[model samples]
Target chain A: MLPVRRSILGLMDRLMSFHRGSLWVGVVLVVIAPLSVALLLSMWRSPFPINEMISLLEDAESSTPGRFFDPTIRSWYRPLFHLTLWGFWNGSGSLLGGLHWFRYLEVGSVLVLLLLFVSYLRPRTGLQAAAALLAVAVMMGMPGFRDNLEIPVLMTLVGMPMALLVWMLLEREHRWWYTPLILALTMTAIGYKEQGLVIAPVVVGAWWMGSPGARRTTTAVVVLAVLAYLAMRFSTRGHWALFEQDVGFLFGELGEDEAAARFGERPWILYGYSALATIGNILFSEPSRGTFVITDHALSGETRPWEWISIVSSTLMTALIAWWGVAILRRDWSADAWSAESRLFVILVLALGASGALGFNYARDRLGGMAVPFYAAASYFAVLSVAERAGAASLKRRATVALVLVMLAGAWQLRAVGTLHDVRLRAASTHRTWITSPNWSRVTFAHRPRYLSIMQTMTPQGTDPARARRPTYPEWFLALIGGG
Target chain B: MPAGNTRILAWLIAMPALLCAVGLPLYESSDVAQPPAMADTFVEALDDRNVEHAYLFIRQGQDPNTLVRFRDDVRTGGREVQVSPLMLAVAGSDDNTAAMLLSFGARMDYPPNRYVVCLAREMGMDGFVDSQMSTASEVECPPPSGAEFPLLAYVD
Candidate 1:
């Protein structure tokens, strides 16, 4: 008994030792905590247009491998995303299970992102490590705009992080084989989204700025890959004319009538403002409405107080973050810090701008993938700047200041999360009101008998109009609402 | 102080704060005690064009004559009409008088759509009056879909 007691005590002491315990604790808090929250939040989410994603997935799953690359079948070239969804669906055993698992994948991507940030920081000291963890925590806990939290948006959300991770690897590795490796990775990224094509320019910039050693080889490889990707993309059904028409609308050269004739009544201003508002929404405004309300509602020459507030606050916050980042860049002139900071900042700005510019709508989910890395970089810089300044103070004072910063970041995260929670609850209540209320139910029942039949079918794909007579919701949806 | 100790101190401070940051919201979100107001529900229903639910809210305490007239007006109208009660609420209509007049333009079945108004009045604690009690008025259809009716324009 005495021997066993001493052994237990010894084990406890060893476990609590600085290196092992602290590192494990950091992993749990930084990675596990955020992931758990994401999982929990995901469970609360109801399907937003689950039918469209299921249809697309079904089509992809049934098609031949070569068909995915065919432009006539799909408007865009996103084979990897489609394949991933198909794989997930096949593994999940059921359609609803697949969707639930997809949310877990989204949450897991965030964990991967946090780890990437930690690796990027390469914390040597305990203070730096703490800052890295805090930055990740703040980023993970920050509320995402509600629109981005939906299932279909997870494709973009997951793809962006994967691309960034690959980009980071490309930048860090210096082997002779890296040029070809980066080219392959770049092709993979583009397969996820057209924005993946931006990786080519990013590679060029990285090579120009710091990787002069392998400049020619890297540039040649990337250029070749870009040409190949373009060839493959253009070979698909949709010609470059489709892209040209979009560009024509973006520049407002096409009149409203012309634009409508080509692509419905959507105006160029809608796309421009949506892009601007994506950044604005992230920096300011509540997660619930975002800047979408501003563009949609206020565009008719009427304004609300909250709209003004969203615009003003978004502007101020953006400026503040930029100013803070620039201040740190000026103070910390270390080549490593400067290169990393500047590269990330440029990527963030360009990605956000380009995404908004190219897309027809400003969807929060579309912005979310880019926003994750942007926020991570911003938080890292802010923490690093503070840590550098704190080096001047006494150890105790510095520790105290660090604690305060962590607390403040935590508090900010709390407010954001709390708001998101409230918004989600409100949405659920609204959905319930629509579903259960007498008048609302009557109209839905009468006009949308097809909805009832679809709901009753429970099948995500291969529903023949002649055979499937009942309106059915997905089994997963029923399970989500505690009915299944 | 030792460097290790300083690092330990920093982790100690950060971990608990991080836990609170995520855990607090998680804990708070579990409590689903408070449901949204009926007016909010009505507004949502109206916005979603769930006419049956909207009617339920605006049907309370309505005169039979008014109810008959409202249905007759809808049935007789050639074009589809959409009333936005949420828009009225956004425009600062109180619980007692939140309403929006909807204008129907020229559509497939009807060459010219007439104007109809949906009004919400609080009926004790139950909910709003049903759609039958909601006001309806006939007006000339706007030429273009974007053109607004008098009441709807004000609400917008």
Candidate 2:
């Protein structure tokens, strides 16, 4: 054979190899492709300390362990999330420095999540080496992935998905310490984000599907764990700071009295609306910009060019994913009552439900982070299933079509990442401009003067032109930005 | 035991699962208020010059970097110009609106902002231009295209 053909075959041999060492190497190879793209497109720069201001202030107010559980200090209780911040704060000595550490951890977690997911899929789904890499790339390329990676405080957004994959993997292992292990996992997830409560249902699903031996004790533990969590959660101040004045914010111009009057008796209506809208935002490419929701965008009948592109690409991708899912269920129905395909389908549905329901307070793109992985896994299975059933002649044709859809979705996701990167860069720029302006002192302090002063002191003094314009990654990395 | 029973079990758990999902946020949302109905479409309350609304909106969650067009009535030369809130604030000479937006991280790097810089120079709002330029000496504007843009129709 020619040299090029020989090299190609050799690489394929290595990729298809199941050697213990190479398996890990293959997983790393798979992770790097998507992680590199994500890093280049979204997280190549340090972010402004705007979003993490409250957490930093809370930490400053009390360097005590008790503050983590003090729900009155913030809208909700998130100890593990704050603890991670506290670790960074003490280690890095400034909010911006801590955020840089967070940026690194965010990417590191993504790498770990992908590694665990790829390892899990290898045995269960039997995806080819190349297909596994592609699936991970497409999953990480989802629009919500950008939001998950860029927002430092929203580390739990990424963590919850990791927890979901962990639960799925753990269910397969009927170890002796399963009860405590699962209980610990559940608590850790809840401590990450309020939405981590979704993991409880996941635990229940696992108990139902997995071994019957541990059911009684597992059920007792899960129930006790959930009850304990709720007891602690409800005993708190019962306030979302976004709508309260104590945190120095109000939902738009609506005061607490006005908000209470509006959503008073039937807050469920608002919650339900937000939940549905959040789900719609995930599945369909509905605009979620500024104060605008999909309804407003629809009524206005005005969409930016990129918004239209997102809508078309996302709607088509959703339709394709749904079609592929139905095809898998139909094909696998005769195999078993609960085949691997069916179980995964069930997981996908549950995850989507959890993602939407998590938005009961309000809908944001990051809320849908948990669902994207399952969506990507389902797509992987669907593609493999189709290719598996096709005759040799038709295989190439089907693969090409699937590849095209993946490419389109990938491009759309990159656009979303680019937009996020632009927003962050602008945020950094505007922050520097604001601090340096003569009118900086005259700026209103909606939160607290102390918090603002803390922020001002923490902000890097004097703008470096390079930092203002764009982050200075290595020259080779800079070259990847345009290609990304 | 049976497949059908498992399906039943799934349904049984779903109700509590939902309650688990919605219960916590709702319990905490006892004092929470809904966003304004027009909050979605109206990107900014600059048309009404409602500085308080803008202040709260930015403080709460609205991205100040979002570029919104000025209302049609603010048409120049009988046409609507797609202007950033910063530019419109400068145009109407609302220092409070400009200052509030700027402090909250409104961007001046958008392509349209260069036009705003020129407009600021033309209007002799030198102070506004000076604040935007951190290290620059003077405002620069491209020659006008003399194009007439149409008015944006009011959305119902």
Each model's Cα RMSD: 12.4, 15.6
Q: Give the DockQ (2 decimals) of all models.
A: 0.10, 0.03
lDDT of 2 by residue, A52-154 (tens): 5544655645567667767677776688777777778677987667766766776567666666666665632223433444455446545556556554556
TM-score of chain B of each: 0.26, 0.54
Candidate number achieving the greatest lDDT relative to the actual structure? 2
Give me the displacement of residue A394 in model 1, in angstroms. Answer: 12
* lDDT of each candidate versus the true structure: 0.48, 0.55
lDDT of 1 by residue, A6-124 (tens): 99999888876755645744654554455445434533443334245535655755766666656566556787777666667677875566666766776566556656656656554
Model 1 lDDT at residue B120: 24
